[model samples]
Target: MDATWILRLDAVGDGPRIAVKDCMDVAGTPSTVGCRVIAADALPATLDAPVVETARRQGARIVGKANLVELCRHADGINPWTGTPVNPLDSARVPGGSSSGSAVAVAEDEADIGYGTDTGGSVRVPAACCGLVGLKTTAGRISTQGVFEFSRTLDTVGPLARDVAGAALGMAMLEPGFTIAEPPTGTPPPLARLRLPDVDPALDAAIDDALRTAGLQTTDVRLPQWRSWITAAKDLASAEGYWAHRHLLDRSEHLEDRHAGGIRQGRDFTAAQVLACRRSGRAASAHLNALLDRFSALALPTLAFEPPRIGEVRRGSMTYLTAPFNLAGLPALALPVPRGAGALPASLQLVGAAYTEESLLALGAHVEAALAANRR
Candidate 1:
């Protein structure tokens, strides 16, 4: 298995362990950001990113700086310099990026929680791939300061862990005064079961069966703007990403060609196009809010396809099921639902209204319990 950490060290504090994504400054360590060029040029961070500081203030022992895709760009974890974190479920398969190492660290029990940033599925994709729980807090709900971000507008520090409870702990570390809502005991929360094209049948069956077993009410929702939302997110990300790291071009000699190409994508969009995409993002958020007003949350597969083997993913493929929520700036929870004994698990993504992480996580906990009982 490839190394899951950029820098491993003695535990930093006296509480539950945390594996912070290398893109976030951890103080005293150079934030390698899973890039050789950046690593060579980077200096030790003099202070912790606010997100990382929360964990320290809460008594979390910072155990290691986890690796991620270079520039936090790719959907699959395949960093040539840092090496991809082998998927704990199957070493030959891909661990999703750019939070791959953070996911693997938690999956392998190296840390109680893994802190990662999710712009377009970075946190949830890795959690889905590694069979863990990942929570993408509402954009701006968590601090982005001191973190190297892909899209300044979309990036939010999130947490990945093995279960809902661990995810909550991770959230508490990222968000001061964060509370994990108690599992529902009376009526199950209403779910708007979101269906997009190209979802695997096995995944559909798993989500459907789990919700049914959990006695959760679900109403079908098929948003027509799904494709448009994806486009707007890509354009916005491209525009913002270029601005975030174009300065590294002077050191482009050390940058991977693919990453260099990604940085240049912003140049492809005209100012008019960037402005249009920004407007589209606002529309997407408003549309989603209208739906959220009725349903407790939206449920769907975290990934439309199962975790691909190493080298099997294409750019933009992994984000189809995840990016829209990020575009809408909603909090999303990716919870693993066990399939047949030998089959790989499927991830059930629950997206909630802005700042409704507590409700969403509570619903996840309830569904998790029901699925476990059904498996027994």
Candidate 2:
């Protein structure tokens, strides 16, 4: 099980054990975004990323550097350099990326919690694939000072854990000065379930049954022009990603075809196109925010389908439903649910208004507990 650790640290703390993505700076170590090409010439980080430093201060043990898609450019956990981390749930399937290793570490109990950066559904997709709780916080809510920049507009640090509480605890530790209000106690709050075309029937049914068991009322909502918004967000991410790594695309001799292809896609957009995309994205955020005003949270499938075989992922066709939230800068959580007997795990996503992570997590905790009770 080559879980893709650039460096493994000695267990040195009594607090929550953590596996941080290789993209995050770790003081003395060279922060490699799991790319051997760049890692060969990478310089050691003089200081820890704000998130990693805070974790250490709070007594969280830093276990190792987790693996990820090269430059975090791919959603499918396939890398040409370091081998992809095997999905602990099923060896035949892709583990999901670009936060693949972090999710794997937490899923396999190698770490109590793991940290991953979400540029475009990186953290959430892997959590869904691995049956873990993943939290992608509101952009800029936590500092990104020591992490590699992928898409400046969409990148955010997040946590992956076995349950909501572990993830919540990790988030609290990472943001030392920020205060998370107490979650609403007792039964889960009413949720707004997003009704989108193209969602898998099995995933929809799983979420519906889970919500019903949790005693949470679901309101069906179809955001107008949703598909256009998704496209706009995709364009914006590509533009920003291209800008972040254009030099590598232009001159690096060690570029992988998949990684280079993504960068080139970003390069194809004109400045005007990117601005138009951002404008469209902002409009979408407002539209979603207005709809969210009437409900405690927006629920939907984390991904449209179950994890595909390692080589079977159809990059453009496999929908990553979580990306829109990143574009909207909303706090989103992925909660695992049973798919069926002898099936891969499916996940339900709960999205809340920006900075409402506490409430959203509280509701998730309630639902998780309720589902466990129902199973018994």
Candidate 3:
């Protein structure tokens, strides 16, 4: 029997098709984590990662393994081991990473949904760039047992789909003891809009137009200082990621400069620095929690700027806007909005309180349905 058929046969449900990110173990396949070094000698997984197993058990067809950034290190989705996947919307531009292929698969209609681990903005970035919906559920909401780690505390299994309903359906299968809530009939709670000091005017206008089209009310608010929190998140992510793959880095015959660079940054951080970063995370979480208490969700642009060109190092505040939620361990949903003049999709992000993924999905579904009706 063909190996692809064998894998697809394991799927139990007559449900949506899904492509698991390469970093995730799929039982009969080697978990490459998007690096030739790992794939060259790695053994096939003896068991599926919990997320993948659950997805198959829930009837989602395991179409194939999607490519990712090398070692899941870069946000740009360039993987030398497996060629970069082009954004379906704009072939000249990069499909966001480290979940690049997963997003591309969905965007190109190869799969109904794509499952990937989100550490930082992996899933959201690609989803937005591909004009899809992606959710980074609260930390610990989905099991990560067989998935390769980036940051144990920040890593999460999330899904990207063409619409909010597809994402919600995918989440139900991947997350144990979780299901999408029924559509809310009453008015949605007020949304607290987050206006970054340097937000792009075009993106801001798109967000406002989306809210107005959906008849959603928004009140402006600000959370704790984002730069400090993001800095800490980066430091800790580097440290954790370094330790998780230290053996590979030490043993591999040849390590790519990009992968080696990230690993090396984490090598020098003392335990004391990790602790300080944790403390910073706690403070940021507390402030965000307080704001959530007063608002249904915090709204912001998923990406403050356009997707960077292939091979360009994206530098600036726009790159770190989603880092705060990952550091805070909150639930964030990235929903595709209207396209910009360049034809690439604009995305609006909704950050919810911890463990509030169901509510967030409910709200997202509502907005998705409203927007699809051409309410304007």
RMSD of 2: 1.8
| Ten contiguous residues with the weakest lDDT in model 2 | 179-188
RMSD of 1: 1.4
Q: For candidate 3, lDDT tens digit of each residue in 191-304?
A: 999988667788888888888777889998865587788899899899998898888777555677768878878999999999999888888889999989988899889987
The number of clashing residue pairs in each candidate reads 0, 0, 1
Which candidate leads the pack in TM-score?
Answer: 1
How do the residues 169-217 of candidate 1 rate in per-residue lDDT, one tens digit apiece? 8888877788878766777647899988888988998999888998889
TM-score, every prediction? 0.97, 0.95, 0.93
Ranking by lDDT: 1, 2, 3
Stretch of 10 with least lDDT, candidate 3 = 1-10
Model 2 per-residue lDDT tens digits across residues 1-376 = 5855657888765889899999999888887787766787899889999999998988889999988888988777777687888889898998888899899889889899999988778888899989999999998898898889988888999999999888888888887654445756764446889998888898899999998898889888887677777787788888898888887854456878877787888888998998888788688678778877888899999989888897789885443587778778899999999766798878989999888888888888978999889878
- The TM-score-based order of candidates, best leading, equals 1, 2, 3
The Cα local distance difference test for each model comes to 0.89, 0.85, 0.81
RMSD of each: 1.4, 1.8, 3.1
